[model samples]
Target: MTPLKSGTQFSFDLLAGALTGRDAARATGTLHVLGNPGGRIHLRDGGVICVESPGSPGPDALLLRTGRLSESEWTAALTTGTRGTIGETELHVVAMMATHDAAFTVVAGEVEDCVFTPQTLDTAVAMSVAIDPVRLLQETSRRITSLLALPCSLSPHRDRVAPVPGADLHDLAPVREEILAHATGRRTTRDIAFAAGRSVYPVTIEACRMVTDGLMTVVAGTSVIATAAQPLVPLRPRKPPTRRPPTQMPPTQMPPAENPLPEPPEGDDGDDVPLPRSLRRQLLPKLFKQPERKKL
Candidate 1:
């Protein structure tokens, strides 16, 4: 008989170890794999389960098996995880542990036609222990299918109406408009995205940025609370004067005029003539006006 490779034999031994206390090891039987690359194993108590290709059991089964799930536990975990649908292949196995009465059978296949025998024990254990390459491969296929069916995780960084940190201001133009529109405080990030015709991720990021920049305040949902104007400071009051009031003056009567004009000395030039009183009075007002104009 050809000796199995270290890696292949190792995997087989590891699975067998899990069945140490099980009746499968006590019963005399052969482990057989069919289709494509067929293989077989015969062991009495302390026998191990192995496969040429790890993919033989499928990804999900392999993961669970590798994770060391018990027979019943494996069944329960797989069932719960795959409650939705099973797309692709199936796992089938028949094992006689200890006595014929202790025989166990498991069939892990498409979600539509999954069949497990002896429901007395949970399906998890049976699936885990009886997993072959074929079943493992089918589990892997199912895992991929289930993953695809799940809703994508939403980006935590995205904000629809509020500005977020590290967001590009230029790209936020549409977000800004939307924020202004439903800003009536009725809409949320979802609402802003719907109204702006933009993705919720970018919109939310932009809104967060705006809030951080102080250009806008995030109120409830799509609406942003506008910044309040700062109040003006009042001028200081003037202090009252401590000095005494000025004295009142009495009115005076006009004095009688003497000579109307004085004659110039002999040989005096006309250039030395005194200016007229009326002209002097008019000139004073003009001078006062000029000073007032300068102050203005």
Candidate 2:
């Protein structure tokens, strides 16, 4: 299918123009938004049946979180109901909500491209409820406005969150507590919502409040990114090696001085000598000298 390029500010009119049918009948097909973190919207008979994206929480999340349904209940909805207890009405509501959130996510941010795949659905056994494209767009706008008004430190949908030190959990709502339980600083709001089986909108709103109350803190960038993964940069260069001068042999050693004087004769036993070693050395020549052999 040919990809339809979208502008920076994505609008409902733009999406409708690209995905609507010629006869104006319910456009039945899937709308695929292509980008770093893209989304998919399923239309049955011109009404939105389902919506999904990498960044937004899914329909199952909403139902499970709101206590509207359990994991088994949602699983049952997907089946033909031979053993599943969930009814068609509940499934349709879940799908409608999921689609609304998905559509908002798709058009709220910058879209790179879009593709619509035309197809038909067998509605005989399954319940299909269609949403008006115009209404869907309006709701998306309202959601965005609400999120902008929140006093959040980061984008609750994209930023990872963790509970702060000395967090007060005594009066927290059940939903907030659940979110806090999973706020490990590794999971984004979207991830926590998915894990808790709750909708992204409510979870995000709660997360924002938690942050404002100092119960939780954002771990990543404050703003949102288009892609699920960030781009990698090249490594930094290393420092250059240093040079050193060659070593030299120390100067040749010199012998120590000889003994200043020989030992005194052993028989001399100089009893008359009373001077110290130093004085004896000085006066030895005079004291031991004999009269010059009668030279006189």
Candidate 3:
């Protein structure tokens, strides 16, 4: 399909138009961003269900950042092919927040290369809950304004942060203090956000202010080290491995064993008795002897 022209109309505008028309139909599909940091938005029943971008930190990171779910639990859930027992409402809220965050990050830039594809059961992610379309639109609108107001230095997933030596920390909010405390020169805004158990959006925005205020400094081209303590992203459960058919075993044959009985002692009273060959022979002989006995 020809990509949508990026003027007054955006992918979101198109989606809203389609979903809210007189037909009042539901839309389930993926919106593909075709720019440098491309992304996908999964929708269900005209509501945003999930959002993902190569350039953005996802919902899993936001979930982990809240400290509501432990690393071990998250890992086990992913490994077991289950989302665990997190409440539907909670997950929906998290998904909504992440969707807005990602959408804001990706759509704020030039979107001339964006496209949408209607998805069916074969293509869309199976989702049990979805964010309300109105709510999602509202939140996205809010974040766009918030995003535009943010400092350009506050790069969401790219910039590294470091605390200034001998900086006064008394005036900082608790969340900001937590973020600042974890800002080693080695960690990026993303890493600090993970360590502080906060979302990247707010944490990076605050970190940017700190940089401007001389409380923290930005480090160039620092790479993040993956660790058990700090999982930078959420992990999805893997599909079960395919099983192979059982191999047939070859049959084996063995010689039949012989049965043997022990012989009786010579002249023993309990010696093996001679057996009559047939019942008729023994009966006919006995009947003839009965007639002779009668004559005697």
Candidate 4:
């Protein structure tokens, strides 16, 4: 099976939307999808009956290859509705499983578009039951959750794995053993499923377990390398720069006081110089005009 392509995004919600619309209208037809492993979803009264995808093993492939029914037996079931050993109930179970499984691969990958062809199944096909589309999509979501929870998330279509050298293989489950035996570093888990004559889900899950057990390693240059979520370190807030106090200036010095008056010399009080006019007038009153006895 081709893995979901990188760079082209697809979501389960898109598939859900399409199915929900069909369910509301009670439309019966085939929803043909185009993508990496594009295929068709056949609906009966808005319920999904069969899903066919290049990336998945359909009911016919599972039934015929798994040896539940031989070629002649399958043809009889299709042609004459004869279920000799594995009866019609077996056919229904196989068909349901195939539809659910194929729907998962389709949703997990990319879908370019879904164009509904208004038609009904002829009376010749092996599948006679129509599955609830809502239930199918819900189960697809559950499968996605289970896949993401795996210790190692291996894309069935993207990541090819290789068996570890010198690894112990005794007493292991048949499915895991089959996975390791077919792991050649070039074939992906989907391919391994085909080779082992098994379904994609079990093979992929086994591959994940092998990866976790260290019995296998994903080949280099696969998309599965970066599929797991990485832990992030929380960022610390930045601190403000430290402020310096303003520089202190020395106290300002006052200049020496200037001498406004000259220092007095000794005996400088002896009057030698003429008095000012204002001072003479003041002194003459007491000095002369001795009354009016005057110049007698």
Tens-digit per-residue lDDT, 1-296, candidate 3: 01111211243444344333333236667666665355776766666667676555666776676776667767876677455667767866776566666665554433434456775323112235766644544454444334333343354545567888898878777877787779888776656755765555566666766777888876655523322222111121225536655785444533322221233222222112221222113222332233323433
lDDT sort, best first: 4, 2, 3, 1
lDDT of 2: 0.56
Residue 120, candidate 3: Cα error in Å is 5.2
Rank the models by TM-score, top first: 4, 2, 3, 1
User: Which runs in model 4 stand beyond 4 Å of their true positions?
Assistant: 1-9, 22-24, 75-83, 121-126, 227-296
Steric clash pairs (candidate 3): 65-197
Best by lDDT: 4
Clash list (residue pairs), candidate 4: 3-157
Q: TM-scores of all models?
A: 0.19, 0.60, 0.54, 0.69
For model 4, what is the alpha-carbon lDDT of residue 118?
86
Q: Write the number of the candidate with greater TM-score, choosing between 1 and 3.
A: 3
RMSD to truth, every model: 44.4, 39.0, 36.8, 42.4
Q: Which residues of candidate 2, in runs, are more than 4 Å off?
A: 1-26, 60-83, 108-110, 120-127, 220-296
Listed per model in order, the count of residue pairs whose N, CA or C atoms clash below 3 Å is 38, 5, 1, 1
Cα lDDT of model 1 by residue, 61-122, tens digit: 43343343445654665667542222222321312111110110011101111111211222
Better of 2 and 3 by TM-score: 2
TM-score, candidate 3, is 0.54
